[model samples]
Target: MNLFPINAGNLKLDGGAMFGVVPKSLWQKTNPADANNMIDIATRCLLIEDGNRLILIDNGMGDKQSEKFFSYYHLWGNHTLDGSLKAHGFHRDDITDVFLTHLHFDHCGGSVQWNTNKTGYEPAFKNAHFWSNKDHWLWATQPNRREKASFLKENIIPLEESGQLKFTSLPENDLQNNSELGFDIFFASGHTDKQMIPLVKYKGKTIAFMADLLPTAGHLPLPYIMGYDTRPLLTLNEKEKFLNLAADNNYYLFLEHDANNEIITVKKTEKGVRLDTVYTTEEIFN
Candidate 1:
């Protein structure tokens, strides 16, 4: 199996929101904020090429939203999803599966796009089967007031409308071994209900798609949860368990929202599991 890091785009978000109650004095050391208190974020998707099945995990926020809608996020970057796919000698149409970690606008928005006539929305990848679990599908479709803004109908409804939506089998516990997508899935709910974190076996190592469970290296600290998470206490427990597992097993965390750090490894330190080493995509994938 071959894997590639797909750069969808970059944007900036309020550091306070990203790091929750963590003081700026602390988070800023690792994720330094700009003058506007906005920290850099990347929609880094992952592409898995295993024979005929080309699976894409979380295809960034698409370009369909209005300028006014995007302005709030302060989008900035040259890395278009199309350009990144082409750079790796592929296209959206080549994707067979779109494994969404969650239905947040940034993670799954690129799954659907405006049709040619611009009359209505349609599946962006004509040939790909969009993947989400029953729990997450229900949570996103019937979003609570706290997460309503992040779960946009335009970004989600079209996949089901196109008759290409599929659901992975939900795990009895938090972790599902060897899912339909051929990888273990770590189900996390603190960030959002049933956010599936893919644990992929690549090149003799486990590469975890650290969705919002661990957005950036700065979030390694257990208490450094995102303010967006609905259940911050649950997140603390989940992160503690997962981080210890990752550290003990020596997993390479593939960070999706970290613009600066691509992949990171954590070790069991005296304080706790702290960042051990950082690696660029080239260093690992190549």
Candidate 2:
């Protein structure tokens, strides 16, 4: 199987919110903020070419939101979903599956787009079967007040409306086993309900897409949780346990929101499991 690093693009977010209660002095060293306190973040996606299926995981934020909406996130960079796909000698039509870790705009925003008529939304990948967990799908669509802003209806409704939305079955007691979850249904409730982090076996390596669970190397530290997470304590516990298993098993973690570091290795230490090494997607996948 071949793995492709799909860099959708970059956007800016408040560092304080991203780091939650972590002090600026600590987080700033890893992900330094700009004068406005906004930090650049990458909506990094992954393309999995296995057997006859060309699957894409999380299609970054698409260019459909209003100018005022886009301004809030401070979108930047030359990277784009279409451009990135073309760079890898592929196009949107070739994607057979779009495995969304969650329905957050930054993660699944690129899944739908405005039709040429500009009249209504359409599935960005017309031929692809969009994937999400049933529980998370319910949570996102019926979002609570705290997460309503992150789950935009425009980026969503259309997927189901297009008749392309599908849910991956949640394996029973799978999250308990580091090697469980027959097809990788990682139940990380802290970031969101049953966030589906796809585990791809590529080139004899276990490549697990680490969504908001371990967004960046800086978040490798146990307490460095995101303010956006609905349940901060759940995230802390989930991260610690997952990092320990990741370090023990030597798994490669793909960062979806990390603008700088791409892939990283975790190692156990006195301070707790920490980033032992970092690698760009090319270095590991290529």
TM-scores, all models, native as reference:
0.99, 0.96
* Highest-lDDT candidate: 1
Clash number for candidate 1: 0
Give a tens-digit lDDT track for model 2, residues 1-286: 7789999989999999999999999999999999999998999998988767888989888989889988998988899999999999999999998988899999999998899999998998989999887888999999999999999999999999888988777757536222322245567888888887666666677787998998888888899999999999988888887888789988899998899999998899999998888898879987
- The residue-by-residue lDDT of candidate 1 on 21-85, one tens digit each, is 99999999999999999999999999999989999999999999999989999999799899999
Name the runs in model 2 displaced over 4 angstroms: 174-183
- Cα RMSDs, all models: 0.7, 2.1
| Candidate 1 runs further than 4 Å off | none
